[model samples]
Target chain A: MTLEILAFALAALLMLGGAAVVALTKDLMRLVVGLGAFLLGVAGMFLYYGHAFLATAQVFVYVGGVLVLVVFAVMVVHRANGGRPLVTSQHDIGAAAVAFGVSGMLVMSLRESVGGWLPESGTSGSSIAQELLGGHLVAFELLGVLLLVALVAVLLIVGPGERR
Target chain B: MTLLWGFLWGVAAVATIAGGAILGVWWERKVSARIQMRYGPQQIGPFGSLQMIADVPKLLFKEDIVPALADKAIFKYAPLFVFGPVAVSMVVIPFTAGWAPLNTSVGVLFFLAVPSIEVIAILLSAWASHNTLSTLGGLRATAQMISYEVPRSLAVLAIVLLAGSLRPLDVVAAWRWWWMPLTFVAFVIYFVASIAEMNRGPFDIPEAESELVAGYFADYSGMRWASFMMAEYGAMIAASLFGAALFFGGGWPFGGALGVITLIVKAILIMTAIMWVKWTFPRLRQDQLMSFCWKALTPLALVQLVVVGVVLVWL
Candidate 1:
């Protein structure tokens, strides 16, 4: 029991520390590294919550996909040295304020709404696959279609002049 | 008790990686020498077997220099990022019955996913060095890994379809004679993708020495550089072991201690094959590598997956 508590506390600390690093870092690449660390820490917490599938999914999606995408985007516009500051500028202060305000509101609202609610035990991979293919097939197909449309839209917007 | 189990397995995995990397270095030199019709490592232990033993101290004692304009924090720590995930992935590789260090439910997925984390480390080293050549190498690596990962996962997905489980042990145990014809295609794809993923042989654009001047870790020195080599060899060994586990009947041919020995021998054979290819083939052009992944491998893997899925459903 004590071991479990210590593990949880350490995971929480890692997540918070990574978050702090991401928020405070001044280099673009360093910010991406912090984001990767933050994602990994969150994935560890998901494992602690007894959702090994969710934890692995979190790693696959965030660490593998989104992190790579974010890094590629940064690399595209990345300056060689310390030319670009990663910190929020004065002009972006309003955006930052709004972000914090919205997140705080979300936390408060969720706390009030689900005060006594407990999450169900994690679902098995097979069950989730069945749910996606059988019970929620329509929604799954819709999501795929939406992604396809988004891909086409991006290509149309960013493709060579001939297609446009 | 579980703690002891985990610790013991961890120690064993570390020792395997350390010993494997040292031996792999010497073996690769010998293989390359034999290909070139020259004696290699003849002066070291016996047939230059102790060359790696000599090289380790040389690298360890050399000056660890940091670039004047480098990002000190990332430069100092990036090698850990490269080596750590590879080491962690070793835990999921089931060498024998009931012997995998950490056998999670999603074993194969978790095993494959863990090693992708090394991409960020390579990127950090390239960017932190503030060298254009290293940056180019890093970008090439990131591109190659991302491109090849799709077909790689799809090939494994095909195997998972036939096996109907993500557990490494299950995958190996599910192998049957009839499943061979289809999985043969997948096995080839997996082997090729694993080679590319480890950044070796024909796919080794990131570290193409003549062009990129040692690629992403060009600026690294001493033990730091050695760490990168260790990580590379470690990943290679892990991938070979995984390929053995997934498709080659794993440790089932012989039971007990012999089973373990069989699995290790299979992995070593695969590693030797990789080394053979590495020395024999010229590196692909960057554009050619990308096209091969996207145009050739991805489509073929997807088609193979569809066939496996269809067969599994109807037959």
Candidate 2:
């Protein structure tokens, strides 16, 4: 029990530290890498909670899918030297204010939720699948439609080119 | 006690990764050399078997170079991100029945999920190096991985649907001899998607030498660079092991030590096939690579998944 707590605390520290770096860094590369670290740290926390499937999915979807998309977008718009920071000091105060407000609300909500937390762990992927297919089928179909719409929109925006 | 055992298993995993990487590298050189009609590493050891092993010391002893304008910390840790997940993925891979280090029920999903993390490492190293070519390479890699990952997962979805379980052993168990003919398409799609995902030959446009000039790792040197190479071979081994276990009947008709050997032999056979494809296929143009993945493989995998799901449900 003590060990799990220690592990969780360490993961939380890593997550927060990485998030701080992502928020504060001047370099665009560091900002993205910090975000990757932040995502991995979150994944670690999921693992600590015995959600191996979720942890792996977190790494797969965010670190692999979302972060790569973020980097690719940066590559297209950013300079060759990568010299500029994506976020500048002019935005810092406004960003900090928003961050604080969000954090305060989140903390309060978290406190409210903590009292009802379950002690046991481990949710198999099959159970999640069953819930998604059986109970949340409508939501699942909606998500699929949403993703399909997004794909079509992107295709319409980019348009097709000459095929080989 | 669990913590101590986990630590020990982690150490063992790392050692296996390092050793397996060396062996894979050597095997690649030999196979490619044979295909190209030349002797590879003949002087280093018997049949040049120790060449990659010898290169380890050389890579370690070489001076590590960081680009002058590079983000030093990001550059340093980038390779770790590339290799670490590949190493950690060893835990969920089943050698035989009840033999995996961590026998989580989500083993199939976990296997598919882990190696995709390498793109982050590539993107980081490329961006942090402050080189235009490196950045381009990184962008190419990111695009390639993102495009192929969808189909890769979709292809695996067929297997998961057929097996009705996410565990590696269960997926293997669902396969009978007759089922092989039907599932072969998914296997091929998975194999090709994996090749693209691993950024190997034909899809090796990310680091096309004539174009990008070593691509993302152009500025990386010494042990830092070695880490990236190790990561690539590690991914190869993992992918091959996965293909073997999932598609090639896994370690069956045996148990215990013999089962482990059978599993490895199956994996190596798949590795040989990968090597053959690597040596034979010419590199695809960047645009062609993207189109082939998005326009061809993705739709095929989606169709395969649907067919499998339908068949599983109805017949």
Candidate 3:
């Protein structure tokens, strides 16, 4: 249990560091790298939670898909732009302080709440499946619909936009 | 027991990486040669089995060039970023019952996620190179992966619904009794999406050799290039393993140790089939690849997902 806590703490620190980099960096490419690192750290956290599945999914989807998209978009838009040193505005500092403060408070509250709650005994793979299928059936169905809508939207956007 | 399991798994992962890399390279060359109407590496040992081994040293010794304008730190770390996740993903892939290294409840999810991280490596490599062609290739790859990933995830969701568990072993067990039509559709979608996800032909627009001049890795050489190769082949092997576990019923032909062997065999067979497809088909244009994913595959996967959900809940 102590080892698990240490792992979680390490992952959280890495994630927070990445987030700080993303917030502070002026370079667009560096920001993307920071985001990737943040997502990777999140994946490590997921692994600590005994959800290796979620960790991998987080790595594959956010890091692999979204971050890559962001990088590519930056590359395309900034093709001609090169060697321009990134400049951070003073407003960003104020925004960062607010973000950090709110998150810190939330984390503190969560820690207190977690301390009061009784830990659930080992929920095996079978139990999780049962819960997903039997209890969370509505949410499961909705996810399918949501995915379908997203697919249609993507097609309509990408397909006609190019042709037009 | 955990330590013993870890040791075994480590050995399996290494062997899988080494074997898959060697075999995949040889197979790719032979296929490419046949496609070009020439015998490939026949001079090397036994149908060029040793051809890939000979090329490794050459690749290792080649100059590793860092473009003058590139981000030095990210550029240096990108290859490790690409290679690490692919190796780590091997843990959740169950070769047989009681064989997986990290036998967690979320095996399928874990398997699905590793390849996603690989895209980041490509994106970073491109950005770090600071070259137009590399950046363009990276953009193409990013778009390709994102468009295809939705369908890939949805298809896997359908399988998860049917299998009733995310564990690779459970997925195989669920498929033993009957091959449902929805499962078959899910399998087809998963297979195609996986191929695209791995950036293989005909969806290999990201690394279009002719147009992009080796695409994102145009500036990369030596061990850096080799790392990319390993990641790609690793993904191929990983996807094959996932496919086998999900659709073909992993480790079904035998029990115990032999079961693991059977799973490996299935994965290799699937890899070869992918290679065959790679060699046979012309590469798709970027637009066509995106359309195939968003327009064709995604809707199909969604339908399968709903069908599977309904079957599971109501029927």
Chain A fold similarity by TM-score, each prediction: 0.80, 0.79, 0.67
How many pairs of residues collide in model 1?
A: 1
Q: Is candidate 1 or candidate 3 better by TM-score?
A: 1
Model 1: residues >4 Å from true position, as ranges?
A: A81-85, A91-93, A108-120, A161-164, B1-4
**lDDT by residue for model 3 (B1-315), tens:** 555666677777767776788788888888788878999989879997887778888987988888788888888888887877788788887778656677777778777777677777888887788777887888788788777878888988887787778787777666653654557888888888888877888888888988888777788889988888888898899888877867777787577888888988988888888888888898988778878888999999988888888887875
Compared with the true structure, model 1 gives a TM-score of 0.94
In model 2 chain B, the worst 10-residue window by lDDT is B171-180
Q: What lDDT does each candidate get?
A: 0.83, 0.83, 0.79
Complex DockQ per candidate: 0.55, 0.67, 0.51
lDDT of 2 by residue, A1-164 (tens): 88898889888988998998988787776788778779989999989877888888898899888888887888788887648556668877888999999999999999998775532343677666677787779999999999999999988777765234
lDDT of 3 by residue, A1-164 (tens): 67667678889988998998888789877777778778889989867767655566677668766776676666666752376336467787788789889999999999889774523532455555566677688998999999999999999888966795
lDDT of 2 by residue, B221-307 (tens): 898888878877887888888877777667776767887899899888888888899899899998898889889998999888888
Q: Candidate 1 residues B153-215, lDDT tens each?
A: 988898888888888777766777577687778878888888898888888899999998999
| Candidate 1 local Cα displacement, residue A143, angstroms | 2.3
Best by DockQ: 2
- DockQ for model 2 equals 0.67
Greater lDDT among 1 and 3 belongs to 1
Question: What C-alpha lDDT does candidate 1 achieve relative to the native structure?
Answer: 0.83
Candidate 2, clashing residue pairs? none
Which prediction has more favorable lDDT, 1 or 2? 1
Ranking by DockQ: 2, 1, 3
